[model samples]
Target: MTWLTALRALSAAATSENDLQQVLDLVADTARTLLGFDFCGVLTPDAAGESLVITGWSGLSALYVDRVNTDRPVRLDSGSPSSQAFHSGKPVAFRDITAEPEFTPWGGVAREQGYRAIVCVPLVAGDEILGTLNGYYSPVHTFTGYEIERLTLLANHAAIALTSAHRLDQLRQLNESLREQRDALTRSEQIHERLLGVTLRSGGLDGIAAVLAELIGRPVLIDDSRNVVLAKAGNDGELPDAAWRAAANIAAPQSSAPVPVGSAADPTRRFSVAIAKLSDDVAARIWFPARDTDLDPVAVRAVEHASIVISLELLRIGTAVEVEHRLRGELLADLLGSGAVISEQVLQRAHRLGHDLSRPHVAIVGALSVSGEPAETRLYQRSLSLVGDLVAPYQPRPLAAMHRGNIVTLWPITDESHESGSAAADLVQRAIGAVSRTVDATVAVSAQAADTATSYGEVYRTAKGALDIAVRAGRTNTVVELGDLGVLGLLLQLEDPAQLVAFARRTLGPVLDYDDLHHTDLVQTLRTYFASRHDRNRAAGRLHIHPNTVTQRLRRIEQLCSADLADPAVTLQFSAALTVQDVASLN
Candidate 1:
């Protein structure tokens, strides 16, 4: 091709092709065709900008190229002709490579390739030197001024074409990036819309989980504030133990963004967690195992969107649950009321709540033990959820509610063998045990089953009373059932606790007031004397006091109460009052 035609072809190829390497190849071929050189090469800077690398070449032996690239690549400071042309932004010529001192480093390469002379022309784009376009001749031929001018002219045009190709490549990459971003935004929107639809349909947590799993192509799960599995999608069995441990390490992400459970590069780091805040004190976490690979940015955003959906779903479910909880509490109050009648309206409400109060059922009450610090309401709600979840399998649909500041479950009896109610209480105790991690808890099961709702009041009272006395009796993290305590059954049955407190205060008022004023253990002394079976010496040893000191305290106690410890009825009165005082003081 003519030089002009060759320039036209180079410009056309540069403008049309977006690939940088292909443009470089075309430039190499065109330079060879016009200059009548045996070999041509297009060189670009290596990554460090320290050397000229042969990015594209024509008619060069692979062994020569390989030796130069791997063993002795020309660096900018190497004082070589190509480096000098690149650094100086001018054309450089060596009339005879074999005699050129600067070509010594590349001597073996040139000899092997059989080149006698070479020219290095800098490819200048505007003010910047891109790299060197080199041509090789097999026989000695000193470049004349005319020949140098032609090479320079061709090199200038080649620079424009290469610059155009580089810019086109950039524009193409930018276009692809924008397309990817647009598609990602579109995908995120679709995922968000689908998750929102699940919420609007009241599809519940399971629905949200399923949608999240499908969008991310990974298994998903939701755990409650307690780290117990609340719902699962794309999986049916237990997750890795590392998941729960990792979950415990990171606080729930405050926003919808998902927090990764493990290190980004760690293969063991398998789960991503997002918190669905229900209240300040309670939240649900949505998790997806990374499995073999981490989620992409779009998938991570999808998880974030899923978290919002989950939070909304949890709120909706929470509101509905709150309403049902109030209704259940009201119904439980009615059923457990002292003289509650089993009306049809009540039965219908019970059925609506999925409870069969007419069946043989017994009341079980789980009470939160009094804490030194006051408990927050959200803690109570979370604890109740845990308790309900634990008993759900046994009760199918348990009639449970927070009534009178206690969780009451009227569990249906599958076997009235009496032991079954106790066995059920054991399971309830385990469930309540989970709550104890946050706050202490106690469970009490009634001794009898109520065949109808009318009888529910009595059965519930038995459980409630035992739970009350159990908590007062310093029972925690355990089950308390009817018939377990001897006098507790009698104490709660005969009188309301208020009545007993009053009776104790009246009988022990003088001695307690005296002991308070003097910082004396008059009550302890009297109780120790009675507990030692009326043996003064043994009582003194038990009280960690001298026997004569105990005698002196007992005489003072008699003087304060104006009653003799020797009288049987007087002893009974003091003993009963002390027992009531002891039980009342246990908590």
Candidate 2:
């Protein structure tokens, strides 16, 4: 066949043949038949890109193919002609194989195969050198310019065909991947719809757990912060006690490490805990059996989605509770802030709210020492819950409200005239004990109980003043009465915050400035030191550092501010400034 006729035939076959190997084989056969070469071979790089392998061959002997294939992979070394052409992206020709110095070892093998001259044309696609098309001549022959051009054209065609086949394979893989993603998304959507349906139809956590158990093919258990199981589903005879106990010890929701309680070799009897937090106060865990569960990406994604739905449900419950609490808070505020005119309408409204205005009552105010909005909110909620339990003992049901980050309560005095004085002091002492169990705070109560004749507004103001005194006297988390705050009480009477702030700035400004410039905790250290009654050991323990460190810091403070902490007068001034600073911070 003529070269043009051969080229036309190969182009037609390449258009029809989708098989990459068949196109390569056709290229080799055409090169041998149309170009009058003694032998032709098509070589391509292997998967690892480190070597070339003979993939197609035509007009070559069995011994040649066997010897080459037996060698398996031909490394891309400088001694090999195919590697030279492939790396250089240009044709490499040997006019006489025996005359080429690099062909000393392979020249004898070529002579045995009846080839003395050779040419290697790189099969290139863009910047990548895929392989080479090699032609051999028995008699010594120099490749002319015309022959080289024809051979280059044929190799270019082969490169285009190889690139097309590779792209076709990639397209097929992409289509398969897209199909898999669509199916996964559809499954997730179906799970979401089922969960929503269960939420609407059953309207309970147990029903949601049952639905999730059925969908995920595992037992599902939901628990509150106290580890009391609220709902359960698909519980077989086997109990996951180890996972359950571990989850109870977890203060915060997290993916905990697997807890092993069985014999070390018991592989089938293990569980992993993945938690889904529902709210700041509520959380749930999905205990998956390590042996039976796959824990694939899809399963993990489904668990995450279930956590979101559970959070929404918990938030819904909390919202309803807040609405009730808000009504109670509004009633409590009205009772405390209202005047002494005991109208019949006011008495009836107080009656429905479970408050008795006729009986003598002592007002108690509790303030937390923590900072930040979240911390304050947590303290407020926890304090409210504790107070509710504390006041159950005292009758004339306690009225409570969270006002300005303080839990204010009005406890009824059972014996109005005789026992109101001692009863108020006793109530204050009991409240301090209860508030300490959850968070650190200061508790104070009115010295005298008030009835309809005295009015709730006067009692509330007295209780508020006692609370302010308790905080400023550096007696936080302690119960105090109005008389206990001696000089600080007189100082707190000055309510102008600007005057208070200016006094604090003038007193502690040098120490604060030194702290800011040095990134030191001198302000906190100084406050703690003075609060500990100048006891270096107590302050050192609180700071969690050495006593020497505290002593050194105190000396630095004395030098920076030119104030001696040893002097009682100077210590009194610093304490007063700190009190003012603390009160201003709360505002």
- Candidate 2 local lDDT, residue 279: 39
User: Candidate 2 — which residues are off by over 4 angstroms?
Assistant: 1-80, 93-120, 126-151, 197-208, 221-233, 236-287, 314-327, 340-364, 370-378, 381-400, 409-438, 441-587
What's each prediction's clash count?
1, 0
Q: Across residues 423-529, which tens digit of lDDT does each residue of candidate 1 receive?
A: 87777677655664567767888777877433787777777778877776577778886678777665644425677788899999998899889998998898889
TM-score of each: 0.68, 0.55
lDDT of each: 0.79, 0.71
lDDT for position 366 in model 2: 72
Candidate 2, residue 359: lDDT: 78
